[model samples]
Target: MSILNSWWRALVALIFPPHCPVCDLPLGDEKGPICSPCLASAPLTSDWALRNDTPCDRLSVKGCEVRVVAMLKFHKAPQWRHLIHQFKYHSRWRLAREVGRLYGGKMAGSLFLSDVDWVIPMPLHPLRRMWRGYNQSEELARGIAEQTGLKVETKSVVRVHYTRSQVWRTREERFKNVQDAFRVAHPERLAGCHLLLVDDVLTTGSTMRTCIQAIVDAVPDCRISVAVLADAGGGS
Candidate 1:
């Protein structure tokens, strides 16, 4: 059976060769979603697992203690932006997870998830999730969990209110847009657990603030840590 399955996979690969998501070139021998040549051009941040001030200071307002580690710097170059759009807007969830795996392996070697009790992907509103067909953040979290052996908590917190796009909004506008947008389910179940919130990108930190507010409101003692695949405005 195992040999037959291998042959079946070989046949499938022969029938449909994989191509790189970024350049659309035949992947050839590359094992990653993005071809190695394209992946090398990605703007990776200097610090992958180290506690960085960029994201930490962004959400550290409202007297909440937060730590952050960002993988990509989110360069505004066309290739980088297009790559994000491919996964985020083009339904490439596996690309998102594969990107997560890229950094999750490094995190496993560091103290990033050492003390985290839960890997909580920033929840998407049900309507948005349904529209997109999958939560990219959750896929990223799953990839990280696969590497770090952390538990992903999908149902504990949810986005109750669907939000308008925050891409063009000012920092203040973004905060107002997401106010009271998240709700914690059965807070007692996660009373003292340490939560490592995962997101594909870190923008103005408004959405995260409200989400953290919701979680802390429900479970006051739960520690909060933030991990983002890209930092849109990390050091601003």
Candidate 2:
């Protein structure tokens, strides 16, 4: 990190005080986005084991495993939502990298992220990317790449359309909302590589599924898995 970056980080920490993502309390020099208590309390689907099964098999697409190794569950934990909301809707770009670094560090020794060749973030619509100064997913990908030493290809996957928000939608509505929303921009790099798809949160799995499908269609031999900071809601 450069001096300018360090200064900027210090300024951010002073302003936000490094609150726990799950509790919204000061972290007290713990060197993370969340405190130890919140990290222990956060829900994780795969702890000691790595399940290759997709969260929603019905939405499974070819060429990607689609396993969601999420750190925290979304609902019933208002603080996680608030933290994610702050990064997404608010102009808290610092929080995205912090959250990503925390999650990526947790995944360092985990077998779930062991074989990834690339870390690819789910792209936002161009309009949304323009409206928002930064892409939360890209920030997470950058942080993961920094820790994992894996390449992050930001231009490989792109959102072809802008759909309505999935926050309050039902399962069916959510599936309809993200259909054909993403397309692969560079298939050559992904053709024979194992990629890990990253996102801020996993709710219905519709958006991730669509993005995975697009990549598989474009690159027939590409292997993929999914990871997120939070996983909210139940799925079959």
Per-model TM-score on C-alpha atoms = 0.86, 0.81
Give Cα-based local distance difference scores for all models: 0.81, 0.77
CA deviation > 4 Å runs, candidate 2: 1-21, 26-41, 44-59, 62-64, 75-78
Model 1 residue runs over 4 Å out of place are 1-18, 51-55, 76-78
lDDT of 2: 0.77
Model 1 over residues 46-164: C-alpha lDDT tens digits? Answer: 46455443437677646468888877765644456666677889988888888777778868857656688899999999999999999989989999988888889998998999998
Q: Residue 126, candidate 2: how far off, in angstroms?
A: 1.7
lDDT by residue (122-167, candidate 2, tens digit) is 8999899889988999999888777767789888888988997888
The Cα error of candidate 2 at residue 25, in Å, is 4.0
